[model samples]
Target: MRLTRPMLALTGAVAVLALSACGAGGDDEAKAPETATGSLEQLAAKAKCDPNMQTDADEIRQAICTTGKDKYILATFATDRGQAEWLSGAKDYGGYYLVGRKWVAVGQEKTVTALQGKLGGTMEEGSEHMNPGGSHNKGGHHS
Candidate 1:
């Protein structure tokens, strides 16, 4: 079989188109939202909670939300770097974190997990910092 240059180009184009079509099919579900895309209140609404505004600043906005009996902190950052920095510092406290782009929800493991159902995010577990010294007994040393 003899293949001409034009025939080769056409074949390459067809292959590219086929691959693109395959990728497009499940893109909606396959790709997570690039960003949470809402204010603290809006996000809280999505999780079925009315946020009690805790901190409203230019760089970040935070609020306390209670869905059912579970209470969680919902925070959104103006910049990705700010969110990452905040997460890094907060993780030292050791708790459950639901992280989405430019936003995070912090609370108990169950609470965070439940929030994940309504808000799409990845779960992160913070490491607990241990006390260096033994427990200080306020009762004083026994004789």
Candidate 2:
């Protein structure tokens, strides 16, 4: 059988379409599964907590949640920058933070770890602020 120009063009077009379709599907598969992001109440509900409203401000909405005697503060931010700034400042105090998309849950290490299992966030730790005299004090002052 002799090759023809029309048949070659059709074959090339079909190949292009098949490649394009494969590329599209590959992109979808390559991407990670989207994590759910929600408000303070919605997230607390997911984590099975009765959120006590702490601060309901324009920049952030915060709630104190107690899960089985483990207390934690869950906060959702209006802007990513605000959340980052808050986290930065809070880190100096030394605690465990379960961080998500524009949201953070502050608590003890064990509590935050447990929350992360339910909330799906990365664990962050603040500085322990230890003094040279084997003391975990803020200003390291012993009078």
Q: Kindly give the number of clashing pairs for every candidate.
A: 0, 0
Model 1 TM-score, all chains together: 0.65
lDDT of 2 by residue, 62-96 (tens): 77776666667788888888778777766655566
Clashing pairs in 1: none
lDDT of 1 by residue, 82-143 (tens): 78877766665456678998888876665666667678799886643311111322335333
All-Cα superposition RMSD per candidate: 22.1, 24.1
Best by TM-score: 2
Pick the lDDT winner: 2
Task: Quote the positional error of residue 135 for candidate 2 in Å.
Answer: 15
